[model samples]
Target: MPLANLLTSLSALPESGSRDAYLRFLKSAGDAALRRSGGPEHVTGSCFVFSPEFDRVLLCFHRKGQFWVQFGGHIESEDASVAEAAQREAREESGISDLVLLSPGIMDLDRHDLHAGFSCSAHWDVGFAAATAPDVEVSVSDESEDVRWFPINEMPIQVPAGFGARLERVRHAAMSQSGTQIG
Candidate 1:
């Protein structure tokens, strides 16, 4: 039911060119969109893990991409939904078990191309917002060289292009829903 869940989530998105692209990709690829073998272009689940106070966010130094990014990757066969996949990825990558979803649906969508040496041509990333206690301990996974929390106003310079703006939007959405003031 991952596909069905994804379709429902994507459908709930406000009308926009990005939403159109996601819908188009799902429509053409069908269930294959959830798997890597679907093609170079596939759906990915990611979470921007934040502190309970919303002042800091968790990012991993991806071993492959060699950059600090949110936790996420391909949607596996066992994933019940894209949100679940995002949560699972966050837990696995950050070693935090009690993260809570801040948004009811997908928080943002991103479509980006990979570098020449990577496996996929592009990733239509489905993003979610999640939070955990600020004092929780974190351990780096094998997929990352390092894992740590960064203040919302002081992200690393090595992040992907436009990551700052994307983070701001997700942060605002999460803050808005929880009735918390934006930091």
Candidate 2:
């Protein structure tokens, strides 16, 4: 029942080819979507954090991949919802506070080949759109090499394989849904 609301929220999204697939997977797997015990694919969450004015976006240089990425990671057992997991991961990874969720449903869904030591063979990533205050400071966690904001135009050059496209989708969602917007 923990994932019931998340499944409901995801059900509200205007499904695309990829989102439809994620929904199908969730329908079939249920709570196993968030569990990693013996499975190769598991749920992960992340937020595309925007600056107050919505121009610059926050990013972290992952210690593992050594490239810039939106703040997010594996959803833990304590995470009751994918949205909460995404907000928590963004706050923890970016050191940004008072981040507001722009949408309650899944903003984006992506499947990637994850070779990270912490994850299984693949990641079924659920993303949320969030906005942070302008004056907030960022702390670089041990999992990251650095934390900083980048212009949308210059943000994609070094983003790892799956991130660039996902960020773009979140940016579009934010702009459409958040009134002002950030890319």
Best by TM-score: 1
- Residues 144-181 of candidate 2 have per-residue lDDT tens digits of 98988887667747777766666777787888786763
Kindly report which residue stretches of model 1 are placed more than 4 angstroms away from their true locations once superposed. none
Clashes of each: 0, 0
lDDT of 2 at 124: 82
Q: Kindly report which residue stretches of model 2 are placed more than 4 angstroms away from their true locations once superposed.
A: 116-118, 181-183
Across 10-69, the per-residue lDDT of candidate 1 in tens digits comes to 898899999998999999999988999999899999999988788999899999899999
**Candidate 1 clash total?**
0
Worst 10 residues of 2 by lDDT: 174-183
Worst 10 residues of 1 by lDDT: 97-106
Clash pairs, candidate 1, are none
TM-score of each: 0.96, 0.88
